[model samples]
Target: MNSFSELCSLLNQVSSADYKKILLKEYLDSSTDSDILWALYLLSGRKLRRSFDITGLWEILPKLAGLPEWLIDESYQISSDKAETISLILPVDPDEKRITLSEMIKFADDISELPDSAELEKIINILKSINAEDKLLFLKLITGAFRSGINKKDIAAALSEKYSITIISAFHFLSAADPYEDNPDNLLKYYKRNKKIFSSYPFCSAQNQDTASVFQGDCKQWLAEWKWDGLRVQVIYRKGELLIWSKSGELVTEKFPELFRLSQFLDDGTVIEGEIIAFSKGRPLHFSILQKRLSLKTVPVSLTDDFPAALIAFDILEFNGNDIRSMPLTERRKILASVTEKSADQEIMYLSPLLEFKSWKALAEIKNSAAENNCKGIVLKKKDSAYSGNDWLSLNLEPYIFNAVLLYAQRSLNSEMYSEFTFGAWHNDELITFTKTSGGLNEVDLIEISDFIKANTIEKFGPVRTVKPELVFEIHFEGISESKRHKSGITLRNPRIHRWHKDKKPHEAGYLSNLLELLNAGK
Candidate 1:
């Protein structure tokens, strides 16, 4: 591959977007015209990012020739205004063949014997000629900071399609696994060798079900659990050694080592998926326990003691060295239950307790009592069904997406959305008045409401002022409840993010039926 293509391939593997842009410019401006192929593919959406990051590309090139860490560091720190001169200059030795770090490192020892001033000037010009994106890609490659516009998966898919390979095969290629290893006769296999893992990073998912049937089908035989406001954990342990992963697919083992201890609670070898909640006594604890342990490099004795965590396992992905993810919900739960029972310590592996309901009314009862039960919300799993896709989002959170009328909204003084709102929170205790809004909107509705809030400000409720709750906001419901703490008689349960309503009037706010339907659907 030409230098630009090779560089693009490397850059495609990187995750950060900002860094990629920087390197892209550098390479494009200073790189040799012969290496223009890499520059061409930078916009192809067909390459992996590893070729650009100094760290990832280091394996390919001679270490000595790879851009110096100190150089990138010096260029990296310069102010944007000064970066032009200090960091990205014209390339040097522009006509020199693109060489791997391994090759360059070997050549480094012979630098004294090579051409001096002319060769040096050429390389500098090549560096300068590399376009901004290419330069950023180069800098990030050398400095290991290639951030690109797209993600690894997206790049993988695009490249897979371009090269006529399966997405999984593309993943294998990006990940450095030889998906085509068995097919040596195949020409593609040659290039496919030593492929990288496309990604271990979690991806954004669409959890919505287009034709979601809430009112129909079975509401009975449904189960409920308090959706704790903590991190979702997927624990994997083969033979003793355990690892905890977050929903975003990040390795959080270093973050919460105490959770690894819970592996001892299980009887045999197994992999379990559950939410890790703060626990006190035999019950789940508050989400606030996470604050102390989030980003710490070293585990503190006090923090570990302060926010002790527990796993409320729901599904069993792997057991006894077998992957059971494709198993039906009924089967998965059965295994999960069995694993918990077999566990030496019952507390380490407790079956997530469920509240069964026969109808929508039963589901509503459970949802209302969620706060009392210390649950953020309830998860409605269709019994005997298998887990699939974003079905989780539809089953768990959709019922709460009610068309609640905007009770009152005002322009927020916050960042993006220029409107602040006070709606409802449904807690069994006392549905308190919970509000959400933004003030950064420069739109027609925000412009109008921004004026209205200023004119109608009543009293300041700390950061939020009590405005005449006049405008209607169509906030989607995530869950509901009656909280004793709220000013609104009852609150909208764990409300989800949705769009603002500019057309609807305040008087048309949602009704009790709006919430009832959701409760029944959820149940």
Candidate 2:
């Protein structure tokens, strides 16, 4: 097999998530060969896709990090077309046999017998000759990430152990490596010595309280956030490198480039967590504004001017090599505030506003005005609280709203037969036989629906089975519109549950015809 194919095979097997540490562990003992490096590149992701097939040396090179098309080309058209040629230069065979991960490692070593360093350089240079389209794939191959398995956290740890450096340092090293760049093998086991408590820290949620008065008495300090309509991002600047990850644990450094610029003002090894909101000069931008920016693999210059993101620093997890997640919110606040550079921050950053509502009544009053001030709601933190559970309550989950769907029944994707209760809806039409329905069920109602599905499975559609639609579920939606995709061709906009009806009848529900009438009436 060709060296690149062997590398690809190795990457495909190692699980993109697990390969970082695994590669460090296996290759740390001695210097790596070209084939080994190639495997890393392919594993990292050396193909444009299953299509655009540049499986060869093209996938492992880095692109011009900060260049814009306008600067490179006088006519935007020429630059756009030429951009595709990048993939052409980094060619992989659609018809060629692909190798396996195990074979890839062995072949890398075998190819290592060749003019070792020269082959590695040759691969990297080949990658550079290609256009930007293939650089990511090229780097993935060289780095031994097939982009299929393995998580990056493990990879960082492996790098730390192999290089005998800090975990944050190892992340930087991996991110900075050139494709076909090889490091030592024993990297995995080497970095496990400094494990910190990444244990859960959160505020209590409103769901847990279940009382209108729960917000009335605060045993501890309390804070309020708008639950801003954006992403929960964690920015970790470690060892002269910057990484920004999302709540889902996906490293989204490239997704938002502007945030990375914070390294210029913040501590190199500090790790911070907060909400990342797309904003205008000084105001919170709409979710759509952020959505447009997020779609880009790299934010564009136009977007930079239009929608910039600012980190609303909420909590400090680590500082100066110390893991402080275990520290109380009160303590973390002190460290977080101390570290905030007065002159270093741009308009994109600001401290989250906090307040102590003397009573739940006060909190409710503030919540009424929160929308006008771009806040989600009031967050209550009990006095003397320690970070605890996985459900932010483990840390302490202040009553927060997370919109989820009821995925069963006629409206749900899972339990069509789970609930026997017929759902209720107001008549959407006055002039038609069917009724339109929506915007009734809230998140709680959906959970009730899910429970009904899970506990009462009977029939099956793929992995989903039926118990009964005995539970009448009303789907709450942001808006409703007619759709061809659904049965009535009536569509829901961001629909979730409004509430579960425990005391209502199914036929009393709004019919499709009634819904159409309502839509007409609203119009």
Candidate 3:
């Protein structure tokens, strides 16, 4: 426990990527296999299930520390982190012994199966056995809020360097094998095998580039397709079983049962890369419709009928138990077209249509009409580029912008100062809340806004403060839609603060009717 806690502290203090790799390799070399596996699991941004509710911790802390509840709350307000607050206030024992990371994981797993009272008792005893630093990590683990600066890429790079293998091989191994369940020997075997039934290849992400630069060469060298706004997925069919893996490496086979029919058209050991969209009536619906299908564990027949799911296949990574990622895009596209042609009659699958353009100006004109066709933009891939090559580019539409007045402010969980702000647009005679954003501001702007929030408060509701609507901001968003859930009868997608509108008056802010007009125009 102490060693793991020390490693976490060291990782938090460093910012250099190369230095982080060195630290991870050193720790991996010195730690036991069990400890190494657990470390990778946590450092790669995967968290264990919360064994107990966080509110339970607040109740237990006041009793354990013999401190007033109000004082604890005040400290929490300042630190803005529960683990840090609890670790600071808890009483430390000089004779406490350290436990191994594997032992700590076992304790958490064991207590999750116990009754509420028994779990609480075991938690208290364990908390008392560890020092304050180790307790912070332990509490973070149990609460499922563990975070280290390192990411999956860093871990894979470390392993690649250590074992003298390609980074892609490391990524495939990590994605296929569950660190929590697989032992060191099993992990080695899987790495050696290099391929598994449910394993996903490292996704090839496109680089964002302007139209001029992307099309500077001969336009015929690039193949364009409409960039669909949907969840990126890889559908795998192997050994008569079908599995769906999201871009984040999550297994989501059961979420969209409508996709199960795809197995009939796919051959054994075939893996098709595509977007899972909420498609109906021969057109793609808004992304919010697809979001509704994601949360339910089981899809009812009626729900599936209303918001049917479909795959717009983009490429093929494997064909008939063979990896084809090394093939050029032109060759791979032929193979993909042939495979998807078998499912032409099926509504659940379709090939993402390739766009025809002879010049950059022609492609730009096509991009201008993308939103009306329910596409984000166009994707351009070099005709002869390999799947593993970095030759793909995405040219997206400019985000819609609106001038809105600041209406509310709130302190974020990571900072005591006011960081989150709600903005509103005019609706007839009143300003109605339309969106909120916490990003796109520098340190100076954040401090200035915090001061404004403090001085112009109109009312307070818990952590949120109703602010005087005097400041205006330029808000940018991807899309807008009318919704009954919002008080303003409207919502914006991916809204963020574009800039502080220092020169604009609050009364000059955009009206809700303008946003509604834009929404209707897209439809």
Lowest summed lDDT window (length 10), candidate 3: 168-177
Ten-residue region with minimum lDDT total, candidate 1: 196-205
Candidate 2 per-residue lDDT, tens place, 121-206, comes to 54444444443334444444434433534345565566556556664545444444443434424333333333331222232233
Per-residue lDDT tens digits of candidate 1, residues 184-224? 12423644552221112233222433223543566654445
Q: Write the per-residue lDDT of candidate 3 for residues 35-89, one digit (tens) a residue.
A: 8888887786667766466677777789889999999999999999988898889
Query: What are the Cα lDDT values of the candidates?
Result: 0.50, 0.49, 0.83
Residue runs of model 2 more than 4 Å from their true location after superposition:
1-177, 184-207, 211-213, 218-226, 286-296, 324-331, 343-345, 356-359, 383-472, 476-523
- The order by descending lDDT is 3, 1, 2
| Candidate 3 TM-score, C-alpha based | 0.64
Model 1 alpha-carbon drift over 4 Å, by segment: 1-218, 239-241, 265-269, 342-346, 389-523
The better-scoring model by lDDT among 1 and 2 is 1
Which candidate, 2 or 3, has the higher TM-score? 3
Give the per-residue Cα lDDT of candidate 3 at 59: 78
C-alpha displacement of 238 in model 1, angstroms? 3.0
What RMSD does model 3 have? 7.3
In candidate 1, residue 167 scores what lDDT?
Answer: 51
